[model samples]
Target chain A: MSCRPHWISPRWMISALSLCLLVLAVTALMLGPAALSVRQVCQACCHAVRGQAEYDPVTRIVLTTRLPRILLAMTVGAGLAMSGLAAQTLLRNSLASPYVIGVSNGAAVGAVAAMFLVGKWIPFGAVPVLSAASGLMVTATVFLFAQRGRNFGHSLLLTGIAISAFCSALTAGALYLAGERLQTLVFWLMGGLWQATWSDVLIMLPLMSICLIGMLLLAPAMNVALAGQRSARDLGVNVRRLQSLLLFFLAVTTAVAVSRTGVIGFVGLIVPHLLRLTIGADHRGLVPASALGGALLLLTADTIARTAAAPVEIPVGILTALVGAPTFLWMLQYRAGGRAGV
Target chain B: MILRAEGVRFGYHIDQPVLRGITLELCPGRVTALLGPNGCGKSTLLRCLNTSLRPQGGRILLDDRDVMAMAPREIARHIAVVPQDTPTDVPFTVRQMIMLGRYAHWDTWGQEIADDRCVIQRCLERMDITSLAGRLFSELSGGERQRVILARALAQQGTVLLLDEPTSHLDIAHQLEFYRMVRELATEGQAVLMVCHDIFVAPMFVDVAILMVDGNLLSCGSADKVLSEQNIAAAYGVRAQISRTGEASFQAQFK
Candidate 1:
């Protein structure tokens, strides 16, 4: 029920986040490694549809490569961030992340097995879809294992940690044995936008869309879940089923992003935490805002990585880790100080 | 109006029973204070009433319909609860906080109907929290937050309101204010069941008191009849001095 003036409620925060996301998206599309003016970008985008011979190669690059990259960055970042947000809420731990708590690690193991282990049975890239499928499988396994009893937190986090350790060890062993292909494998682990193309974006779009809509549908449930399991169940939430469903959705989103981005850490960890400071902990606000914030952060980081040294590109993941870790530390300090005062 | 529990038994595991064979009917339009020391099945029994905790051996009925047979949302439509230490980790505005009570009635997409909005506004007004509506829930003082939670339960507009120790920690003024609000709700024919620790305050405020001991309902009747020295000592293991404060009113003090 509406208890206050409509003007003073959460609608304003939602609209505010929406406006920020739009501005960030436009900025991302207009500015990048190739550098296109807004007018030029628009004209190029407009004329390219009809096979016009008017726009330059730079324009084509923006239309065909960078725009899709930006969309993928936003959607994937959003998915990962929302997953992280849901995980944090579900586990009741501010430090929880799809990656840090092992969901991404599990996915990585799955993907790596698909690449290295599955390759023993098939030709190289013969099962091109193996890594993604494997990632989903691992994520599902981790989710199921984490949701057995009342100790959802310990079960999920501990299982994730174990899975991550196992995956990391296997990945290390695979890298050690690969020899000549180690460079390519290392780059995949470091994470970059070098592989981003229209096809990759097409592959990711449907899954990302489904995950985003699913998170939005569960926004209220996430809100209730934040009140803790007992209270949430009392409030008519089927806590066990809702938790499992959330875990499945989170893992799928995490696995997809990991399969593409190779475990970009802070998009999941930092983005949602940052949004929580301004928007509070309402998942309805946090999920969408985290998506927008993650996309904007990653795209901007990627754009800077490409242009900072102009010919030698820095990996996008490293740049975010550089920025994100300190911000996370500051939040920890702020919260600690707040608690001290109390 | 009729709250019935027939042969109720519960346990986390099958072999161990936390509650065994509890049969009682809670009468309507009265304030029933459930009293016992910790882990005496006070919370367990309350949870069963709303199907938050499933009954292992028996059934709970609300208006002749089995409680477990009804959907959780349907039960929520009739029974609103204020749980212990409801945390506000997020800074939802007071209005947003109270509107969560309307969640059961909300659509799948969480759309707020006009009637829902009206009920929220009325509850906020009733709780005298109209001024606090714009404040972040996390920013409120503990007493203020408690009132907002009470307002949220009121917004559910349930005839049976269940509160677990609604005023466990409060200043004297705030504690008295909470019961005053509870009395008002009861006057409107809502069945108010509250778990209380302050033996003196509950009997003073409630019409009926349910004293429980070792997961058993030891006595249930009007506060004056049920909260005698013998019953209070049996349930709480405390020596008490009972004094008549007014006609049909008594206060208890420790020796």
Candidate 2:
């Protein structure tokens, strides 16, 4: 809508976005307090690949510190972006995001509590598991509320809002209770890949891949659904089943990412909208494009978050919201043309 | 395709049945006009005929196979429905919108084939919306949207076409054109059942007329025979005289 060069193809846009992602990945690997050169990063990666023992500082830094953090950032960004695309498609609302389902707020509650309570060795593993469970439970609650009415989308949105608000209140209560480790709790809530490890990467990578491929497969079905639920049903689509599968994939994807990385908000909201504008609204292309766009966005934001200030690392969530909110608003204002009237 | 509904009964709530003891069949090579007053469950019956709604008390058969037992894609491969209103604010080209009609024609992983492209081109041409093919769906006017919807349904290439209030948004000329298209489609062996309100003009285009009142089927026969003065009055609660509008068409004048 905003005067894009129509000659610029969506395929080119996606390729460019991927290239940027790769470039950013390289740049992010080399940037830190102990600024490794490109050569150091490559040598460390090669050494790790060959299964060399890592008494070396460079391999430890690259493999354990930057690489997992980058991988985690990419997965989380991609997962949330795909979830947003799924939500927007299923709800038939351009403004809808994965967070509209309230799962992240539930994860916030689970994570905030897990971060503070049970002092001695509840295990770091409890955070993501507890968070994911609570997030899923909240979604189940929203689904239960949606089942009471005929207009499932309307009911789901309203119920998701109510539950999310309630969860935010619960999270606020936990924050208030954390008197000693309050700063650490606030930092976690602000969200970052500051604590990324190989375990986190291993946990999220497979799920992200599966969701990406699943969303790609469901893209055409989602296109039919954009015509409205009843009409989609009339066209021989199993609307109920499609809705359930979409909700499940998106909800699980967002819940896991939020469990691991706290609540990073705008990757979901901005990535789909941005890619929809660039790649057009055909979900067949938009789903994969969104994954690339989101990875690029969050990876860039994380790189800036850590390196912007010399010593104090800013939360990646803060940077994303700060960047994403304005960019979304600008697109909405300037790109408010007939094609974007939806 | 013969879509047969046997003693179909449906109700949104348990106590209030919108369609009660309805028995009918939509046969190919004939256009069937479902005529009824407001709240007469004509739309509900159309939905039932397609796989959109299940009858609470009766079974709908599609040429000996149970409609309920068939998978959605299987049913969709044979049946195409143009709902009363589809969301048009979606950001898809008219071409892409019509392409969605082929969702049931192929598997989940299947790409758009040569046949799909040919069918889409035919639909676009048939609806006289070829020039609007590359235009955004949200930019179309109401009548244009209606035509696009019709094209999308036709693009399904199904044997059965179910339309509900399709001509509501059309101008008189477009409405006539739409009915003509429906008749032509019926002549091509598509079982066409459309929920229409214009008892006066319907007899001109449709081969059969089924009249209803308060969810009860009053009469169903050849258009001339079923659309009598008495049947018109019974369905609409009005006294009217039937006048021949054309060789095979009739119009009603109030007494």
Candidate 3:
């Protein structure tokens, strides 16, 4: 075993990573087309003194546009991270994620269908509500399939995969039907924070906060549930009730994330697994750590998406895939080499 | 905590009953070993008692209270169970695993109260595994895992415990150790019901023995009365010689 010390304790690592993320988020807000110095940003934020006295147009842009985008990144990151942690522990599989269970695809299908059918009638904020409803409907369908027998993980995963495939086919059909007016919609599917507004932040903040708090409250029960269904029952846990509550929470959180930032694959899958290696599957630590680490990673990715090509701002989703795929490959190699030592 | 099952009839389908009109009572503060051949419904009966597998027709009374009417968690508060062959895929520390036994005592949030920790400590102490508390259950040997599981039951602080084939994988020393722990728990005023196939050791382990053949109660009484040569032969369909090992100890050999 490698004798690497100091980074082993999860609390220290989480705190260090969270502090670094706060700094990175501030840097993201400060850097844009019209660059504002850190001091200038602080002064502009403070300059909301009586009757809008001499406010910079760049400062207004920072407050309205970039701030909401940063908050969107944080909320989606935290929500996806916590959802991934819950799915992995509940299924007792290292590779389990909200997307692996088809939640993202389900939300995407709902959004695409709603765009095709009801986009003219509904506003932008209403699209997320429709997408969330669709995702939850799919989750309910999968949950019913899971309860028919004793094989919990096997049944749940199989049902999730089946639902994912069905949703993906629907999404593809919608994309094909939307031939000419599909440019912005297709870009949305790839996922970006280009249109993030105060209303979006207003909605996502409370939803993600509630999910995070609820998941933390249920952390102890989730720990018991992770010991497998029968063992959990023998220990006096109501295994069936636990499963229902978890599925509901996971579906809602994942739906919220997908609604905010189209189908951002692999964030949920990778963040929780990396945290598990250090924290050892105790949800008490894993939940909070994954949330922070996820926020940091996406904030950094969004920053690079903005600054990497100054003249042409890249879609944040494309940047995430570009960065995440290589990191995922390296993680796979590390796991194969036994460097993780799990 | 006496367990009484009256006129129990269970079947997967109505056409073929697994347990047919079986009536039995488990005495308080005693270890009762359940003996039966394969496919004879020993595990089914145990499950019925624990309310894991509800009998299609019967009234199971724990301390004369109808088990069917009580909530499962309410029943869990009074009865702890160790199923045969619990699958372990995830690695958990013995402390973390045993802490789950306090679930009935916790609120919806599953808080570990000071009393819960105290009960867990005493359980680990009783099982002589305080040192192994930090060890991962998957990392432990089979014998160690069994003892930790029993400690989890002990932590429930229930009046009755139902175990299914608890010592099947244990060597002779660990087998005796397991039985000794069960006997000690019974002496602490908890009723213990264990299903075991070691007919030879069953006589020495429990105060009473219940013999089952083809889902019917063949015999139920004191160990000496129920472990008779005729009863053994009748239940197993084999000839046997009953020999005395000590002044009060007896063993049966197949002929």
Candidate 4:
């Protein structure tokens, strides 16, 4: 596990990513439309803690707007990436991101359907709950398919595509019935922290911590899992329990992230995939590294999304996809064929 | 640990069982080869014995306790397995690869305890793979990879070892060396049940042979007695002349 030099090892990767996260958070807090100097950022923090006054607009913006947005981005990003790593391990598929495996699509289906058609009858919480249910269904379907082991190629991806397509169609049908709400659904599906608030951070933090802890606990088994499923089981992993628990957590975490921030694509895939290559593949380290890597990646993407073209903000999802979609293409050609560890 | 399968039955489909009520016991210090032609269900039977597959009919017992009812860790403490193929692309150095065998023995946090490291070292050295410890498992040649996988299984320190044709893909020299290692382990008081189709080569190294045909146990006894030419023809549908080359050793020439 300590194969790499200390500088490049998984522990180092986690350290590097954590350092990057701190720097990026501060920078993100400073670089918005109303530029806040370091002094202003400091004042904003102090003012936030002291609850002294709604001082100048600069501190006000930093404290009220950028802080919550950045926090949400990191938490959701960490959540998705951890879930993504867990899903990849559980499914034993390199391409198994929440988006690729239809978990995100399932969440979208639940959110859109609930928002449009069932809103009157259901409580406000139905969207997230329904999204998790649908996500679980999609995940369970793929899990069963994989267990039957038509694995090691595009078959699993194809199944995901089919289920995701069905989910998307259902969403579209719901939107068709409620045509006026189409804009909102489209915006949510595009995914952003555009409306980020303190409440969103509060909602996402506990889930992120849970994902991190769950992933860390599952990390060692996940390391053995890299040996492949049958080997893992024979090596004393309860493969059934490991796979199902991973899928359950993956679906829940991904569904919650999607519900909170809509559907931010590729954090899960790119973060874990990149971390494994750069640091190493031992999950004990990969789990924490991916969490930090996801936070760093998404926060950076978000910073650029806000500042790249000032007043007209780009959705963070757009920024992530700008890199993610190409990475997915590269993986489709490379890691899919390089499906040795899966 | 003595592993015994009694009246074990399994099938992907109910009407066509892959292991049909087969009963067998593996004794300590014996290297047993489960032999048959392709699709004769030796591999399936091994899977059932390990509780990776639950037999449809009877029970797999480890020291008389039902394997299916025990936890995987509980079963693995006594039974380790080497499958026919491991994912070669597993991105770990040989040391890390072998460290995974300690998964069943770890506490919740799973830090490698001092005792675990000692076992890993012994397994690595015993497999003659100490020199390859720093190399990635995926970078090894086929024979080296098999040796690494064997060392990993040995790290489990189980009394019973199950393998499924672990050397079928290796060259003849490597195949012989692999079985020699298995024989050595068996001599050290481990009960080994290996599923292999090297009918010609297997009989030379194994202590006993369990011949199977279409999911039924055809014969089980000393290799010389069970792998008789007639039984070979019956189990594998092949004509062969099995000659006892030496005391308790054999060579098979296919017709």
Name the best candidate (by DockQ).
2
Candidate 1 lDDT over residue span B1-255, tens digit each: 778889888887788777877887766678888887888888888888898888888889888988899877778788889987887665467887887787777778776789988998898899898989887676678898899888888877778888899898788889988998898888888888899887776667898788787767899888888888898788878899888979766776788
Task: Give lDDT for model 2.
Answer: 0.86
What's the TM for chain B in candidate 3? 0.96
The sequence of per-residue lDDT tens digits that candidate 2 reaches over residues A1-342 is 232222236678888988999989999999998998989988998889898737779998888888999999999999999999999987889899899999899888888877765566578678789889889999999998997979989899999999999999998888888898789778778888988998989988999999988988888889889888888887778998899999999989999898888889889988998778766787777888899988899999999999999689889999999999998888777666523434
Which regions of candidate 2 deviate over 4 angstroms? A1-8, A337-341
Q: What is the interface RMSD of candidate 1, in Å?
A: 4.1
True contacts kept of 1: 0.40
What lDDT would each prediction earn against the true structure? 0.76, 0.86, 0.79, 0.83
Model 4: interface root-mean-square deviation in Å:
2.4
**Candidate 4 C-alpha lDDT tens digits along A11-53:** 6667778888998899999897677788888987887788864
Q: Which stretches of candidate 4 lie over 4 Å from their true place?
A: A1-7, A53-59, A114-158, A173-182, A323-342, B251-255
**What's the ranking of the predictions by DockQ, best on top?**
2, 4, 1, 3
Using DockQ as the yardstick, the better of models 3 and 4 is 4
Please give, as one word, the docking class of candidate 2: medium
Q: Which candidate is the best by TM-score?
A: 2
What is the i-RMS of every prediction? Answer: 4.1, 2.7, 3.9, 2.4
Residue range A1-342, candidate 1, lDDT tens digits: 323222223456567766876776667777655677878777777777667724578667776777777777777777888888878877787778877556566655555556665446866443225555766666667767766746786787787778778778988888888777778677777777766777668866787778777887888877777766776776767778877777877877777777777777777878777677655666766666777677677777777777688778888889889988987788768755544101
Q: Which ten residues in a row have the lowest lDDT in candidate 4 chain A?
A: A1-10
What TM-score fits each model? Answer: 0.88, 0.96, 0.90, 0.91
